[model samples]
Target: MTLALFDLDNTLLAGDSDHSWGEFLIHKGIVDAKAYGKANDAFFEDYKNGTLDIVAYQEFALTALIPLDSAQRKQLHNEFMAQVITPMMQPKAVKLIEKHRQQGDTLVIITATNSFVTGPIATALGIDTLLATEPEIIDSMFTGKIVGIPCFQEGKIVKLNEWLSTTGHSLDGAWFYSDSANDLPLLERVANPVAVDPDERLLKHATEQQWPVISLRD
Candidate 1:
């Protein structure tokens, strides 16, 4: 079966879940509004410029969940989904995913955001498979540390290759849709690379490479 890989934030969704989660925490008074918002914006800027240090960013992002137990985390995420993520979902993106499903392609959401955040979002999108950065957990509590290679930049290719090996899936006829230049590494490896409402850098690269550029936003 052909593989259809999707970037969760910005490509499939209208906003960045990681950044929105941080904002959500601030709105809920869970984190210091000024400091967390400043840091979150900085991290997002780094991400856009393709200069993000995934390990450091993960440390910062996952640290917020350390104090919450599994149940509390789930509740908090549900609120986030209802208030933040729901608005980010786009009809065009859903149609794109449904199109792939109609073609019998194996669908997967590959994102740098932790599984704790992206898992439900993927399920809500009707996708069964997701590959995301893993937040370490012990005894049902977050450790605030990542357990494996982060699914970012070249790390995305490494993580996807590992998943492909275990699932007996190959990149043959693979289609990857993404919005950021950060995804160029995995984008280059796919059989079909589509840039979805891409940033400035990715737009230029996709133009030069003759990759299809499409937008999910209305």
Candidate 2:
């Protein structure tokens, strides 16, 4: 069986969901305007430049939910799904997903973004398997901490291997689609690496590596 792994943010959507989710929260006044806003922007810039500290970024991203009740968080996330994330979903992305499904591959979205932000988006795309950073929760309250390794850069390979072990899946002949240089480690490991509107570094690397390059946007 072929494994088809996809990146959630810019690869499948028209925008970066992790950064946009923070902006959406700030716009809705859910997260504070000054502290969270500034940190969010800075983190996004770091991510774009492939210099992001995944652990630190996760702390910043997940902590905003610490003070919120379960019901409130759910409601706000529903709004985020509707207002912020849905419009970013592109037609070409959906079609690509469909094409992969037709190929009978076991589809999984592997993103460095936390599960809270990506779960609903994955459901919307009809993808059942998601490998994302898991936020720690206790008694329905977010602990503002991440469990296990943050699936960024080389960590993605680690996480994917662990998941595959549990499911009896092998990486042989696997495919990965991503748009970021941060995913290079996992991209290189996969048998088929497709760059989807990749960043400059990833674009150059893909060209040098002779990997297929495709665009879901445009």
Candidate 3:
């Protein structure tokens, strides 16, 4: 089967889910506005400039889930799915996914965002397969630590290869769509790489590589 991998944040959705989730929590008073908000903005800026430290940012993002119980976190995620993520699903993205669905490819969303936040968003987008950063848990309580690879930068290629090995698939003719230069490793690995509203770094890379660049926004 052909592989079709997508980057979730700014590639499919109109906004960055990881950053937006932090904003949502701050707005709901789940996180302190002044400190959390400031740090979140700084991390996002770092990400845009391709200078983000994934390990540090992951700590900042996932730790927000530590205090809440599973039920409370689930409820908040449900609210996030409806209020924050749903509207960000661009119609163009849906149609593009549908096109690949009709082609019967093995569709997967390989995102750097932690599973706690991105899982529902993947489901909402009609994708059942997701390879995301896993949050550690102990006795059903989130530990606010990453369990395995962060799925950032080159880590995405490693995670995807592991997933492909278990699923009996190959990236021989796979397609990967992403927005940031951070994904350049996997983007280069795939046979068909599409840059979706890419950042400056990725746009320049795509131009040099002559990869197809498309926009999934109005």
Candidate 4:
């Protein structure tokens, strides 16, 4: 069986999943409204410029996720699915997913976005498998700590290995798609690495290596 990995933020849709999650936190009174707004804006800016590293972003997101009660977090997750996910899924991305599904590939959404937040999006997209950064929880509240490695940069590969071990799969002949320099480790480990609307560093690497490059999203 083949594995097709997708980066959840820009490559799949127009915005960052972390931003959406942060918004949900405030909308649900899980975080300070003004603080959520500021954090999301800063994160979006750095993410777009390729300056925000995944590990740091995960840490920030965990802190943001901490204030919500478990029930509130659960509700936010559901609301995000209904609002953020249902509308933001792109036609082109769906098409790509369909094409891979036709081949019976096991699809996975691997991202630095929190698994609690991104899990519903994956389910909404009909992706049953997810490899994402998970937050530690205590007494039904976010502990401001990550449970596993941050699912970015080399962490993507580590998360993938954990997923494979649990699911009995490997990276031998799988395909991975991403749009950032931080996703390089995942792109390199897979048999097929497609850079979709990659940033400068990834674009340069794709050019030097003659890797297939496409503006999957604009």
Candidate 4 Cα misplacement greater than 4 A, ranges = 24-36, 48-56
Candidate 2 colliding pairs: none
TM-score of each: 0.99, 0.97, 0.98, 0.86
Across 11-103, the per-residue lDDT of candidate 3 in tens digits comes to 999999999999999989988999999999999999888788988898899888888898999999999988999889899999999999999
Go through the candidates in order and give each one's C-alpha lDDT: 0.95, 0.93, 0.93, 0.80
Best candidate according to TM-score: 1
Off by over 4 Å in 1: none
Q: Report residue 135 deviation for candidate 2 (angstroms).
A: 0.3
| Model 4: per-residue Cα lDDT over 55-167, one tens digit each | 66677778866767878667767777777776777888888999999998989999888788788788878898888888888888888788867776787888888889988
Candidate 3 or 2, higher TM-score? 3
Clashes of each: 0, 0, 0, 0
Pairs of residues clashing in candidate 3? none
lDDT of 1 by residue, 1-218 (tens): 99999999999999999999999999999999999999999999999988998889899988888889988999999999999999999999999999999999999999999999999999999999999999999989888899989999999999999999999999999999999999999999999999999999999999999999999998
Worst 10-residue stretch by lDDT in candidate 4?
48-57
Ranking by TM-score: 1, 3, 2, 4
